[model samples]
Target chain A: MKSREKEISKIEEVLIRFHRRHETFQAPPFWTERLMARVRGEKMRGNGFYRAGAVVWRFASVTCLAAVLLALYASGLNVETPYEIVELMFDDPAGLDLALLFASL
Target chain B: MAHSDKETQDFEIIARIMGGDVNAFELLVERYRPLIFGIVMKHVPYDRVEDVAQESFLEIFRSLGSYAAKSPFSHWLSKITVRCCYDFWRQHRNNPEQVLSSLTEDSQQWVDTMLAGRSRDAFEREASGREAREILNHAMARLSAEDRMVLTLVHLDGRSVREASDLLGWSQISVKVRAHRSRGKLRKVISGLLDGRQESI
Candidate 1:
């Protein structure tokens, strides 16, 4: 068993040496240039996405504000109270008083 | 530059990158190219070193937002580099051609010399040859990617489990378990080769 352990240790030593012998290689002369080009391309693509998102956000904000203003206009903002709003919404355009509409309430 | 100065500069460059100055990134690539290449070469095949190194740098750039300055930038860079190598192996794991190369006769002779009860000096000299490397690679190819990486880091490269865990982003216990298991697997591969040789004789 001892001899077997010794043999295994020797094998492990050789394996360690295999790793230690890793060769030192210089980066290719054009490696940095190529890498930088890829990075630039990635940044450009990211910027494109950011710009698209900004445009969409601006459009959505404007559309939302416009919708809210339209809704307020349609709802008769000139009316001052809940009763006035109800009268404004239900009164006939020909000038019916709408008193019957609220009498049950 | 001093280590602290380099760290400070790395932060400065990262700030510029975040602030929309893409050209500033080239400075970082130039500064760390050697370090990145060295790490990749140790863990990746020679032919794939450039591709893997490129992937690592791209990942570093993409992940810069998450780099919280909690540790030295080189340690973070190392973690990325090692992970990239691990990824390369993982991707290649299914390709039988990458894993199925039989041990050559020359490597078999080298293995024989290792077990021939030779002197330590003789063993060292023999282990430095190309055949020794071939044998090691062949044995490693048979193991899974995780096993191969853990064995390489802990057994062959002489890194502690803590160091391996940090580089691999694995829990310490996970690294320890994989390291022990992979070492046993490696031993089995070599012993199987020896037994086959003995049987033939």
Candidate 2:
């Protein structure tokens, strides 16, 4: 038992020494440059994806907005000014009355 | 005080990186490369250290946004490095035989000495540092990814169970259990190697 303990202690010591010995490595002078270059490349690739997604989203949003405008034009609901829309909303007495009731409540 | 100051500086660097100053990232990589490389070398094969270290840096960069700063940035980076090492082993689990067969002549000799049950003094006198590291690496390669990560962090790197638990995002009990199991597995691998050497003799 004593011998086994001694052997284990020796193994532990050797392993610890080994671990400490290998702890620090001299990184090459070009390491930072190489890593930065890779990071830049990755950023560019990521930007490509982001740009593509932005294009798609912008296209979808514009398409939706154009479609809504076309639908409103087809329905003859186009108003030239904000006042006209406000006048149209107030033209409904029931909505005005409901708004007044809610305001009071 | 120094710790918080470093943390604040890291946060500033992170902010700059997030604000589209991509060049600021070079500072982070420069600061942490040695640390990441050291952690990686504990598990990565010698030739593949650079590749794995680079992969860890890229991974850190990609995942930087998710860092919440609840823990120290270094601890979080250590976790990522450990995970990359685990992934390296997972990707190569089936190739252990190939790896073992590629051990250098010096490592093989060291293994033979270990198998002979040489005394500690004899090992100290005879085994070169490279041989000792290679022997440990060989034994480590045979372990499971979890075992390798836990053993490297807790045993080889001299981290406490709590620290390892924090880094691994595992419970303290889980870290303790894994550490125990990993140590057992490592001992078994070493013993098996010694036995194989004896039989070959």
lDDT tens digits, residues B1-201, model 1?
A: 345887999999999999999889888888888889888887877788999999999999888878988888988998998999999999998986774668777776776787887887887788788877776777888888899889888888889999999999899999999999999988887777777667766
Best by TM-score: 1
iRMSD of all candidate structures = 1.7, 3.1
lDDT of 1 by residue, A47-83 (tens): 8987899899989988897556534644654656768
* Residue B199 lDDT in candidate 1: 70
In model 1, chain B matches the true chain B with a TM-score of 0.90
lDDT of 1: 0.82
TM-score of chain B only, all predictions?
Answer: 0.90, 0.79
- Estimate the TM-score for candidate 1: 0.79
Please provide TM-scores, in order, for all candidate models, with all chains considered together. Answer: 0.79, 0.70
* Residue-by-residue lDDT tens digits, candidate 2, B92-176: 8787454554456665567556546776777665544677776677777667777877888898788999988877778999889
- Docking quality (DockQ) for each candidate: 0.46, 0.28
Which residue pairs in candidate 1 collide?
Answer: none
Query: Candidate 1, B46: how far from true, in Å?
Result: 1.4
Candidate 1 wrongly placed segments (more than 4 Å): A50-105, B1-3, B117-121
Chain A of candidate 2: what's the TM-score? Answer: 0.43
